[model samples]
Target: MPITEFLTRNATYFKNDVALVEINPEIKNIPHVTWREYSLIEAARGGAFRKQLTWGEFEKQANRFANLLLTRGIKKGDKVAILLMNCLDWLPIYFGILKAGAVAVPLNFRYTAEEIKYCLEKSDSDILVFGPEFIGRVEEIRDRIPRLKDCFYVGDECPSFADSYDKLLNYCSSQAPSVYITDEDDGAIYFSSGTTGFPKAILHAHAALVHSAKVEQAHHHQKKDDVFLCIPPLYHTGAKMHWFGSLISGGKAVLLRGVSPEWIIRTVSEERCTIVWLLVPWAQDILDAIESGRVNIDGYELSQWRLMHIGAQPVPPTLIKRWKAVFPHHAYDTNYGLSESIGPGCVHLGMENINKVGAIGIPGYGWQVKIVDENRKEVTDGVGELAVKGPGVMKCYYKDAKSTDEVLDDEGWLYTGDMAERDEDGFIYLVDRKKDVIITGGENIYPVQIEDFLRSNGSIKDVAVIGLPDQRLGEIAAAIIEVKEGFSLSEEEVNNFCLDLPRYKRPRRVIFAKVPRNPTGKIEKPVLRKIYCGESVVAQQNEINIK
Candidate 1:
């Protein structure tokens, strides 16, 4: 069955149950505004978990939006671009597109006018829907998007050239139009991070999310009563498809407008969120808050918080240790996945396997995982390219057969560019990306282990380990670090801190600069490599200098 069927089925079984709880009622009054607020006094003010929409109401709104798309001449296979920040309206628009049998093309809200226009042209989007806050940006490109027939904006402050989202829905019928959608039908198209070059459009089938829910929930042991706190953007597969596990099991999904330490603590206490997902940086902030006594876990009745999962990057062992020190009773799971493979649906560390720290655990049920060499021969107990074959694999990269052929083999195996090694116990540990491996003086080094070591240094704010060109050796590891303000350190100090790291794995040099990170918090290594290699590129790292 497809993801739409899971949602439709749950809407029938758990009609009155709360599906999505939106805690942004205060923002309703703020027109044409989208900004993050952070203060020492307030800590985190949003995500109070007061406002909510039940499953029945959610389905009704999605059906209504589906009808609106059909009324606007959007037919099956038509792509509708969704360029908006994370909000209550995001999911409704996404599911609405799926329900209508139209394809959803999720764009990064951070894209500029030029980038947005390029994506629309590349995907051939028929319609564009964005937030009112981006009115100026859309206006700049509205005339340039030739195939863009309609534009709609959410919120009270609608742009002059676009129709109001809420007003448009009122004119359309509530009933969803009948469209024959099969399991193999393309349901959504997600853009890559475009770190290496232009972002590629990834096409996923209707069955993608359904399989993701079963694999994640089955491995994590999610229950109907579990309240999953979703902090990542819905445009990403991790937050969107991964949360389907909770919804399919009649669990409550709490959506935060943004991720902050205070909001995370407040939500866990207020909503009794049992399952939580976070990136390494966000998890580090929560641990810092707890250690500084700013957040008192005992003050809140958070005994219900059980499973906490981290993903989208390698888990620094130091972060896990600090996390365990704060919440000794909490179970932590680390996972590895990508957009092409239906998010973090492939490999997962089970809640019961918390003792197997630093491992991405074994492959989820119904999935076949193998490590293969350059000749495509399977290898045991050695690092090799990770390959997966399962229902969760995406259909293909949209309209790019040449690109799809490079990754997906003829026999249905998808070669994940990530390198991994299996333990004697059959557990999997992600070494690093095949592209990220650094060979210095005939010694090969994976950046993840060294990066994990560097994260333990107190002065290092953020770090990205990348391979740089060398005269003698083919490449050498260089650490680009972003330090906390008022703190100063030298290359010798940074090298000494990693003395415990194996001689071959230690960084050859350290450079002080703010490392750029993608939206999902993964360091943009390709951008960094280009910066050091002097390659002309489309995207550069966005760095924050020390005050």
Candidate 2:
């Protein structure tokens, strides 16, 4: 069944119950009249500080958008692109596209104008619905993209070249469009982070989306009363798929606009949020704030917070250890996946298996996992490329068969270009990305090992390890350290701290620099590689699979 069916059912059964909340303290200062034109938008009980939607309103807004698309001649399988930040309209617009039998293509808000044009032409998207923040960028490429036909502006004082979504949605009917949808039909297109080069389009079917909803609810056991706090960009798959839990259970969720430790804790306390999905860096910042007296731990009521999970990168076990120490009652989990596999649930670490904290856990519900060598043979207790087969795997890398074939194989296994090892107990641990492996003197060195070790130092805030050119050795491990503010660590100190690591795996070069992380919290090693190595590794790193 289509994912919209869930929204429709919730609208009927839980019409008056709150389905979504927009706790945007950043937008609180903006005048309420600015958003008054938007019909689906409404203030919460406390007013403009929190915009919200009931289940009934959620379905109605989606229906309006769907009707708007269908009336504009949108047909089944046509692509509609969305370029917006995390907000109440984001999901409704997404559902609206699916309801109209058109595929929803969500673009990263950080895309450059050229990148946006590339994606528009690549995805063959004719209709792009963007917000005010993206107006300048979209304008620069609006005429450049040959296929682009319509642009819907989502903010006040809409641009002349674009139609006003707020105004247009009000004129459409609030009833579901008469369209047929199926589990196997195309539903959505997601773009890879494009850290290596240009982003690739990942395609998924409606069944894959439905599978994620089921997997999330099964994994976290989301209840009707559960309120989830989401902080990541919804343009990416991680936040949206994690929110699938609330969608499945008819629970409420808050789309938080800020990431400050104080703000996060305040929203959780004020909204009575029971579940939160955080990136590793955000979680670390929260812990650091509380421990350093930057935040008054006693000021917030956190007793209602039940579960906290992290995903998109190899979570430092030490971080989770600190989290558990702070909130012993909280259930913690780790999620691992790629856009190709429909976000972070193909292999998930459940709290039940807390003993395997460092491992990425076993295959998720209705999923199969294997660690295979280059010979296409399975490896036991050895590092190799990780592969997964599941209901949520993408159908293909849209319009790119060669790229799709490189990762996905016949019989449906998606080969994740991540080096991993299976423990004797069957838990899997990610070693590094396939391209991130540094070969020194024929010895394969995983940077994560050295990076993880260096992070143990209290003085280090963040770290990235990459290969710098070495004449004698094929490549040498280099560590770029981001020292914490008010803290200092010398190269000697970082080296001494790495005494725990094997000699060959130690970073030969240490430099104090900022470790860049993309929106999803994955280290931008390609950027570091380009900066330090004086060479772009874009070609070698293009196949990088985000989890």
Candidate 3:
């Protein structure tokens, strides 16, 4: 089935149910305004807005947008790039593109003008639909993208060259377009975070998205009454796939604009959210706030918040331990997936296997995982790269056949660059990224192990371990830590905390500094490596210092 069917089915069967709730305080008191009015208001007072959409209303708006796209000559195989933050209209706009039998290319809201231009040109997106927050960036690159025929503004104001989203919707028909969309048709183009270089576009079939929703629903077992709290950007597959569970179940979900720990807890309480998908940093922040008595957990009614899942990066076992201590009754799950495999849920730590906290758990529903060596042969025990075969796997990297072939095999297995080990019980434990393994004197050291250990220390707020060049050992582990507010830790204290670790496995050099992380909370190790290890000779010097 086409991915848009999820919304269509929900609208038909559960028309009265709440589908999406957007909580943004910036636009709370503002009434409906036109493009010119919005521009004036934007210039006079900068603020945000909120919106809510029921199943029926959501479908109606999507249909209206679909009709608008159809009327504007968008057809099957046409690419529509979406540039928006998390909002009520995000999904409607996405499903509208699908309903029109067009492909949706979602751009990262944090992308620079050059990056946005590159994505637009590379994806061959014919139309660009962007939110107001990105107006400046869009304007910077608007004339550069030659193939971009139209630009639709989603907020109250539309520039002279673009069309107003609300006005266009009002003028279009509120009936679903009679388009023949199929499972094999192109659905979305999700760009990979360019840790090493520029982002690569990973294209997916409509079937992949539909399969993801089903897999999410099966794994999480979401009910219609369940409410999902979504805090991450909608452009990310992690957040969207997680919300697919609630969408498939015809449940409600809240798009929370704020990301602070207090904001998350308050939104969960106010919305009575049952399921929340969080990244490692936010989870850690919430735990730290509660532990420090900055947040009074008893003050909020979080009884309805039953399940909490973490994804996007390696979750430290210590963070989960603290969470369990606070919310003992809540179920915990962890998902592992890459953009090539259609986001998280390819491998999942089932809630029942809470005892196996460190493992990434088994292959998800209808998914197969294998740890393979350099020769492409499966490894039964030792560490190797993880290869996944599943329905949700991407079709290929858009216009990059060479790069696609490097990762994906002809037999439908995606060779993930993550190194992992399989235990005797068949549970998979992620060692580290293939490129991130620090080899010192022929002994391999995974940074995740060291980072997890250091996170357990009370003084450390966040930590990242990177391999710095060492003259004697070739390469040695270095710990870069972000100390918690109101806490102090010297290099000796940090080294003493890791004394129990094997000497080779322990960090040889310790530095006090802020741990650099992306919006998704994954540490930017390349950035750290560049900052700390500028040159080969500089990195060879073993020293402890504060930055």
Q: Which scores higher on lDDT, 1 or 2?
A: 2
Per-residue lDDT over 252-340 for candidate 1, one digit per residue giving the tens place of the 0 to 100 score: 98887756687788777777889898876678678778878888777777789987888766665656777788788888887777888
CA lDDT of each prediction against the hidden true structure = 0.78, 0.85, 0.85
Which candidate leads the pack in TM-score?
2
Clashing pairs in 3: 26-48, 27-48, 27-49
TM-score of 1: 0.77
lDDT over C-alpha atoms for residue 93 of model 3: 96
Clashes of each: 0, 0, 3
Question: What are the runs in model 1 whose C-alpha is more than 4 Å off?
Answer: 25-50, 193-195, 436-547
TM-score of structure candidate 3: 0.78
- Model 2, 445-527: lDDT tens per residue? 66776787788889989999898755335467899999999998888888888876657778898999999999999998878
lDDT of 3 by residue, 97-194 (tens): 99999999998886768879989988999999998888888998888888998999998868776889988789988899999988999999998733
lDDT of 2 at 80: 99
Order the candidate numbers by TM-score, best to worst.
2, 3, 1
